[model samples]
Target: MESRRRTFLRIATLELCERFGFYGLQSVSVLYFVRTMGLSEQGAIMLWGAFSALMFGVPVLGGWLGDRMLGARRTVAVALALLATGYTGLASGMGGAAGVSLVLAVLVCGGGIFKPNITSLLRHAFSDGDDRLDIVFTIYYMSINVGATIAALAIPFLAVHIGWQASFGVSAAVLWIGFAVSLTLPATAPPPAGGGDRRLWLLLGAGIGVAFTLLHYPALAKICIWIAAAAIVLIWIVLYRRAAPIWRAGLKLSFALQAEAILFFLFNQQIATSLTGFARDHLAGTIRLAGVDWAVQPGQFQSLNNLWIVIFAPCLAALYYHAERKGRPISVPIRFLFGFVLLTASFVLWRAAALAGAAGPISPWWMVAGYALFSLGELLIAALGLAVIARYAPPDGVGRLMGCFSVFGGLASYLGSLVATYGMAGSGTASTAGYTHLFGNLAALSAIVALASALFIPFARKMDAHWRHAIPRPSSTDKTPTEILP
Candidate 1:
């Protein structure tokens, strides 16, 4: 038990450090681009969407490389080095749109590699059927929130007080520290996918460049994302056709759910994009709490999701614990269904806030309420999604499937960018009616997604049953197996 706990701590610490550095740059990115690079609101959002797409999208290849080639530890070290270099480069003021885009490409590529590999490593660290998995993940989730909360609070303030470059430099230094710490940890037993060659490396290089180029042009990026999503569906279809009869249903259902997962992220991303702009443009400068005035900055509102997560995660864990003890624990699909419901409620709350703002700048509490609801949904869906994928994915290709799952996040960013751009169309100049239209549309979209997810729950439950009984469990003593792959 002590050994397992130590392993968990090591993995959790690595995750925390990575998120801290990543969010430090991301928390203030919109403002930095707008103020320093002279980007329009829409332009900035689109760029962010592109950056997000790569961060999630590239994981597909990264997972392949990690699981099949270099092992997770080596992959992590290489990724962190790339991340630190990108941060340092940007701190030196990568000039203009093209230059900055290039630097971000490198940064996001590192994240793509780091994200899925670490997750795969963590999943592999435990024996199958370990009841402690959820609790461990809950703590892991909290670690992420801890890092994100600190970055959200500190980076924005630092950017304002000192300089934007200094904030990036700080992020770079922190990433280097994470890299150093990672080396001291116990090594993971590598999985059996290892087959990368020179050609694969060259193709990966090309893919990164293409991703950067597309992101540099938002219109092109949007079009390309749709194309990529379609291509992914086509690939899944081909795989399903060739798959063993027993595995087809699971594949079909998993793919459908992953595709639908995009909708959740579509709504989720407004926190960073549209919500930031909304807080900056519409909220009162100061909020009054208990007869004391508090200054509020729009960037600070970005931290609210993390803040809510820290507060709500333990409550969620307790709920799950009690439920599991009673033999009525929540299933993955049920969790997703509940998540969609909460997402709809969150948007409705935001719409109400937008309506209240028509008279004048509204209180920050409105946003607080909305984010709290959304954060609950995040805990239900996003935090649990990784575990779900790990559970359902074929034992031989867990990392690859997880990578594919991350693609939905990319698609969501693309779609969410469109929504955010529409939401902030007129920004400082839009009339009350314009804001009303924006929030109403978002609310309607959220409701539709929730309804759709509800309809799929029955099917998901059935698929869940089929998968659990079908996949062969590894022997208790066999911690790693190569035969599962080929």
Candidate 2:
């Protein structure tokens, strides 16, 4: 196989631009829902949480289509078009209607398709497996930051001036470009699909699905409750063990990283969701600094995280690579633990910044500092997840495995919304004590997650070592004859 595909750079740049558009809107979505759309705290958080989760969730459906029927290119075109439409519609400030909610959901569905397949295509571009996988993901992650940085700089400024619609329109245009560029890239030979008899596979799939329904349907909650209980009681992840040792280990490590990444995304809702209240209650004055003016708005601060992501991602990636060159054990899960710990530190610092702001209008720089801290965490955890998923998945299961990671992302966002709700109740400028209390809880939670991850690392490393040989096998379904793809 040639070292790399000719089209890799083309795909990465376009995808990065695409990311900018999505995050541009996403960064400011909470603010839009509350301020312009007239949503309450409860309404905003729930919708935002659902939007975040569902956005990740829809990809499962998209992956099903991509792997089973539509193929990557077609699925991507359809999904990106849908995402573009969703952003444009949202830019209309039509967010107040039921149609808008459905539109948002459609965006979620579109994401399921567009997001995963882009990375899938990128990896598929290269003939090698896991060799350059980290770099591949890092490249993709960098694209996400490209958009993030641009969106960060633009959306808040746009939202402050022409309103959400115009800001959203800018994103819509970027998406189109992404779509056009993706189409222009060279195509690959679709790997011959390998599996058992189609008829038998279908029957088994249907039968098991039916059996699952029969087992879990009458009371869905009860089924999940028992499943969780079983996993906990067994002292090991039950459903997971059936997977081969390497995959099981890598997946565990991936989950730990994902848990950290998803939590960051979940907490990210606050920047857009609660910023209006935060700025309104605190911050002394606002003036026109850069053609746009917010008399007093914390929402402008949302851009700081993206800004830092844009500036620091390349640097951090280099640092990681540099460390790797020096024979460091910068394994994926270890990176996740550090990210989690840093995130905890960010909240702690945010509280201190809030306290210091009491004496005067806190420099928007404080939020920037906090965002910088979080963005560092993002680089380590969230950024690495997609690549990890691609590199480690059993060949036939790429889409499904990515879909699983997406589900975890959604679950984390959903849970984060709940956590954010409680934090917001006491997080504004209205009460100093409430604000202090808020960050304290956040720090505590971060600490706990970090601790859990540290404990999980040795196990992750052990599993990774054990499963080293089994990666990227051509067919997971061929039980007796394992054909490893290296």
Alpha carbon lDDT at 465, candidate 1:
62
Model 2: per-residue Cα lDDT over 1-486, one tens digit each: 343544777677767766776667666666566665566665566566666655665566655556665567666776677677767777666745354565665566667567767766776776556577667776666666666767766777787788777888888888777777767766554423555236424633443343233222324423443453344334325425656665776566555555566666665655655444455455555655677765544555666776777787778768866875776736766777898888888888878866875676655555667778887877677656666656555565555555555666666666666565654543222344455666677778888888988887777666656566556554766653311111
lDDT of 2 at 359: 72
Question: TM-score for each prediction?
Answer: 0.86, 0.74
Q: Give the winner by lDDT.
A: 1
Among these predictions, the greatest TM-score belongs to 1
Clashes in model 2: which pairs? Answer: 20-147, 59-112, 91-165, 246-467, 286-295
For candidate 1, the TM-score is: 0.86
1-486: candidate 1 lDDT, tens digit per residue: 787788778778788878987777767777777766678877787788888887888877887778777778878877888788888887887778877888888887788889878887688777576888877887888898888988887887787788888888888888888888778656777545535556446755786688678867778878877887877677666666766766766676676666656567887777777787778778897878899998876777878999998898789879988887776777666777788778778878877877888889999998889899888988887745556545545555555566556776788876787677774445423344555677678878767777777887777777756765576667899784211101
Error of 1 at 352 (Å): 1.6
**Which residue segments of model 1 deviate by more than 4 Å?**
1-10, 123-135, 188-208, 383-400, 423-432, 458-486
